[model samples]
Target chain A: MIEEVAVALDVGGTGMKCALVGADGVVRHAERHPTDAGRGPAAVVETILSVAEGLAGKAYADGLTPTALGIVVPGVVDEARGVAVWSANVGFRDVPLRDLAAARLGLPTALGHDVRAGGLAEARLGAGRDTGHVLFVAIGTGIAAAHVVAGRAVTGAHGAAGELGHILVRPDGPVCGCGRPGCLEAVASASAVARRYAELTGTDTGTATTRRTGSASDDGSAAGPGRGRTMVTAAEVAARADAGEEVAAQVWRETVEALADGLATAQALFDVATIVLGGGLAQAGAGLFDPLRAALRDRLTFHREPRLVPAVLGDEAGCLGAALLALDQMETP
Target chain B: MIEEVAVALDVGGTGMKCALVGADGVVRHAERHPTDAGRGPAAVVETILSVAEGLAGKAYADGLTPTALGIVVPGVVDEARGVAVWSANVGFRDVPLRDLAAARLGLPTALGHDVRAGGLAEARLGAGRDTGHVLFVAIGTGIAAAHVVAGRAVTGAHGAAGELGHILVRPDGPVCGCGRPGCLEAVASASAVARRYAELTGTDTGTATTRRTGSASDDGSAAGPGRGRTMVTAAEVAARADAGEEVAAQVWRETVEALADGLATAQALFDVATIVLGGGLAQAGAGLFDPLRAALRDRLTFHREPRLVPAVLGDEAGCLGAALLALDQMETP
Candidate 1:
């Protein structure tokens, strides 16, 4: 009897993670490719199809039958209709990537939102495993979340549920990428933390008021390469905070505070069992979790404190999640 | 032919709405009774059991076969465990309500949260019907909400999901009943609206600062009967606002603004298809929906706007929802 596997691909702005995963969720084979999203969504769709077909061929070569296909992309996904509605990074505008891939590969397929898929992987195969109600939050350049009940992630009517990063945390804080001011991600995401540190340190020896002064550029050049070699990233800031640097400590504290506020609000609404924190910010380990846990506890009243833990899948989460989706698409378990 | 009916009861702080509903979701018979909660938890439990049994008997007398039982109470419910874990209003502490009802009536039973039950009714049979994903918000003396998808209400890890009232909207707003500051209920609940209106008018020609004044009595007496008949309820405020009362309009505007913030945050997280406004405040009808719809639209950037509608269930929603839960518990369904 031939072993069966799901051909899976997780497409991002810069690259794609491809894999053949067994029904048991173990990855049988894995590979990577550049997405070349700058070439436009049409080219990206072609790349995805060819890459998926190649994975299927590889599965056959490895003595396994490709049972189904699953693909996850960063966009507003219409999962029921198998359409990629829109994506800011990939420029996907109403692309029916699922049908196109299914036609090329001759298998049942599932399309999903990238962040939601990553959260699914985390909820089922990573930190949130065994936790029936899970809220998976990824704190990277831009924050995102997925609320998983049992083993399924809720894709809201418009497939835009779990926009945790954009949930308003501060009313008068900062403008977010979504044009909303004081969104949780505006002040607490990994990129936001690094940016805040840079902003404060640039006008050194002054209190961090989050206000602009004469030294800062008009169009925000300090956030760019114009700040020279003095600029530091979020990871470095965590290290500095851990080492007792006042500015870095302040920035880290502020990030933790904002994240706590966002998570508390999340708990009030979701009331999940576990909150699996992933992406770059979770890499800080105790530096992030300890303070965040404390702050979140302080903010909650009657809410059962969700178990806070770092995600275990790392970068492969989306690919594994795609595999899970594919396996779910098969008629047989 | 004997019709199958579900015996259901919705227990609140003040009253219990009991009914026997048919499989077609029509109530065969309905009645109301005082909860008499001051007699304590045990009495309340006895009252619920007797009321449920009476409803079942009433079904049989009406030539209908009672199939199952469902009891909804205002509190922390353990749906999976079939227990009423906690209730501030009814004074229940870990009562095995479902099992007790099942044992008493020799029928299948389900225990659910009151607001969640009402939301289930709204989502399946009321205003939210036909909408795939529904968020039912009840803004009366206090604000509460239920998130229902595909007919089932999401009972979080602690059976505490959909605490929309407690979600933080204002960082510097009034203190909530739960001791949290700036909760949505602190500023947007019906009681909050009425309180604000009174405070503004009492200190006439002054903006509502949410602060206590010398004339307001030191012991919070203004909220009690000691105000010499000056106290006005939320309905009065709404009527006044509609009739062009300046203070009422300002109070209503502020309430709408705060509610919009809360609902926008809810949309960002849940992204439901429709939002059904129920309970006391929803009685204002278009006076609330028209402005709230616009304000919520203004807050969204990438989010799909959820349909704003008034709940059609009125006060019977909870009883009907209880029937839904009971019907859902039946094996044949």
Candidate 2:
């Protein structure tokens, strides 16, 4: 008998992580492809469809049956309608990606937001596996969150839930990408931290140390070259903070404080059992979690203190989450 | 043939709204009683038990069968544990109210946070009845919220969910009851609005005008006399603002802005279909809803604009919600 598998793809602006995942969530086959979003949405759609077909063909060649397909994208996704409502990253606007994929591949398909998919993967098979209520926060170039309750991630009514990055943390702080001042993402995101550190140190080569240290697992968008050689990543700042550099410590502390405020606000609203910190900044391990946990504790008055832990699945979480969504559709349908 | 009903009670710091509700979500009977919390937790519990018992007795006397009992309280509630974990208003500390009520009433019991219960009611049978995702915000002496999705309120992992009041909207605003500076509750609640107006006008008699106007639908906690005769409640401030009071307009604008910020934060997270405003402040109706709707719209970008409306159930929402909870328990059990 052929082994059953699901085709899963985590589509990002720069690349796509494709995998054939078994019923038990183990990746049977994996591949990568450049998204080349600069080519526009139509080309990106064609690339996604062809890549999915390739994966399905590979599964057949390996004597595996492709049960379903799950595709996750970075944007507002109307999961119920299976439409990619909007995504600035990939230029998707009301694209019926799910129906298109299903029609092309002759399989049931599931579509989800990438961050939510990552959160689902974490809740079901990674750091939050044991918790019923988990909040997966991705802190990279941008900060977003997914609230998973009882193994299901909440897709807000308007497909716009989990925008944790926009919560106002500093009323008079820096302006955010969303055109708001003092947004949590503007102060605590990995990119924000790097920008703050560079601004404070007047050094553009700060990220050089991060690249030198070989900790380049950050989303590529946040790792681009700065104006000068002194540009540093948040990781470098974390290292400097650990090494007792005053300016870096101050920047790191502000990041921690802003993150704590944002997390505390999330806790107040979500009250989840655990908060799984993922994406680039969480790679700092103790550097990020220690102060964040402490500051969150200080901010909470009567709320149950949630366990804050690092995400375990790393970059694989989104693809795995896509697989889980496919698997869930199979079970439900 | 006997009619089946559930005994429901909405317990507050100062009063309790009690009702016997049928399965069709109609109240067969209703009554009110002073909580007299100054008598302490034990006496308050006794009052609760006796009132529940009396309601059950009334159902029997009226030829209706009381199948279950549901009670809602304020503050941290361990709904799963059937415990009122802590409530400053009622001075309850780990009171096993559900079990106690069950033992006395000889029926199945459900315990819930008052606001969550109210939200559940609003979602299932009140203002939000038509929407799958609803956020119920009660802006009284303190602001609190309950997010209801698919007709059930999210109780959070630790049973301390829906604390929307604590989300920081203004970082440098006044200190909140929770010892936090700039909490939404500290700036936008009815009491907060009243306090701000009084401070601006240097008059404590703000609520006096409200009393004179004879619109005392406000929670009694905010109706007490202020230091002088010219004081004003949030309602009075609204009235004054309408009558061209510049100071009142400024105070009201700040309240609206702060509230808008808080609600925008909530909308960003929950992405609910509708936001139902309850409690004393919402009594201003168009005065609150018009500006709040505009401000929320201005703050939101890619997120769907949620409908803002006044809660219909008024003070009865909690009791109605408790009844709904009891009826739901019966179905599940």
Candidate 3:
């Protein structure tokens, strides 16, 4: 008897993580491929299709029947319409990626926003499991959030919900890529931390220099893709902060405060039961969680304090979330 | 044949609006009573019970059958538990008001937060009717909001959702009632407008003075509530701004800017299809709507611009919303 599975993909600017996930969410097969976004969106789309087709073929050859396909990408996704509305990272502009995948794979396909998909996975299978209301915040190159209520993430009217990173936390703070000054992302993101640390250390090489040297592209920037840079990462800054470096500590402290403000704002708005921190910055572990918990608690007044935990699935969350989305479609349909 | 109806009451710190609403949402009868909060929480609870019972009695007398009772109050409410968790306005703390009403009236009773209930009514029956996603912001003494999705208002996990008033819009602006500096309520609420005008004019008598002499009491204590006073109301300030008063224009312009910032943040977060502005400041009509619409549009980037409109239900929204809640309970249960 052939086992039933879903083909899932988490497509980022620099790379894609694909998996053949069984009904129980176990990965039957996993693969990683460079997105080569520098080659343009057309090549990237073709690569995605071929990779998905290969995954399906692999499943069939391995005595597994692929029942559905799920794809998650960075950007605004009109999930209801099965369209990749816009993504700066993948260079998707009004692409009917879901329908294309469904037609190509001859399977039911679901497309979702990368952050939202990860949030769904976390809410259902990771740190926030069993928490009816979960807020998953990804703080990396750029900040984004997903509000999961009763196991379903809210997709705003324009499919632009959870833009927590853009909420203004500082009025006279740094300028965000969105052209606004003092956005939470501009002040608190991991990239922002590295940039601030570099600026304070007088090694200010600008975002372009960092991007050219960094390993990953952020969701906020619309710049061209390049090789991962070999430069100072947010992890190094965290290490320095932990080592009692005054400047690094100051930057980290500011990051925590701004993040607390943003989270407090979210708590005030969504009032979720749990807040799961994901992405790169959350990797700071205790260094990030300790102060963040305290700061968020201090800022709250009458609102119930939520359990703040680090995301457990790490990088696999997106792919798993994509699979979950596909599974949900099957169950609902 | 007897008409079916629900007894609805919108309880506030200063007064209560009670209504007998028919199945079609029409108000069969309406009445108002002073809350007499100075008499304390016990007395207020008694007043609420009396008012609800009176409405039910009135329904029976008028050849109508009261099927259920719905009451909306300010502050954190545990709707699932049918308790008013914490309401500073009505001095309710963990009061099982839902059970009390249900037991007394011998009918199913629903409890809700005032703003959330109002948002529900607006989304389902008022200005936001036909709009699937609606954000209803009430800019009164303090700014508060309700996020209504598909005709249901989101009551946060702790039932403390929609505290839009507390979102920070200005970092170095003013001290909010929540002890936070530069909250939206501190900068743009009706009380904030009056207080700002008072500060700019150097009259500085305080919110109590304005309310004691002004026509309305805002949620904030920055200005006093009473009949349009010598201290000048937010409405008077709008009139002055309309007549080209430089100081008033400057104050009004700042208020609009701050409100726009807050609304833009809300738009980015909720991405709702319609934003219904209610409360006293919204009573400014064109003076508030035109500039607020333009300012919100200017601040938005890629997010869809929501339709900004004045709330049509006026002060009756809370009562209507309460009725809607009861009606909803009847249908869902």
What are the per-residue Cα lDDT tens digits for candidate 3 across A95-158? 9999998989899999998888899999999999998899999887888888999988898997
Chain A: TM-score in each model: 0.92, 0.94, 0.93
Provide the lowest-lDDT 10-residue window in model 3 chain B.
B208-217
Runs in model 2 lying further than 4 Å from the true structure: A203-230, B203-231
- Separate clash counts for every candidate: 0, 20, 18
Give the clashing residue pairs of candidate 1, or none.
none
lDDT by residue (tens digit), candidate 1, A215-289: 010111123222334447678889999999999999999999899989999998999999998877888899999
The candidate that achieves the highest lDDT relative to the unseen native structure:
2
Per-model lDDT: 0.82, 0.86, 0.84
- Residue by residue across B1-333, what tens digits does model 3's lDDT show? 889999999998888989999999999999999998888888888899988999999999999999999999988888889988887767888999999989888989999988888888988899999999999988887778999998899998888888888887897888777777778887888877888888899976654221111112134322444435456678889999999999999999999999998998888788899999888888899998999899988877768899999888888888999999999999994
Clashes of 2: 20
Judge candidate 2 at residue A197 and give its lDDT: 82
Winner by DockQ: 3
Which portions of model 3 show Cα errors greater than 4 Å?
Answer: A207-231, B206-222, B225-230
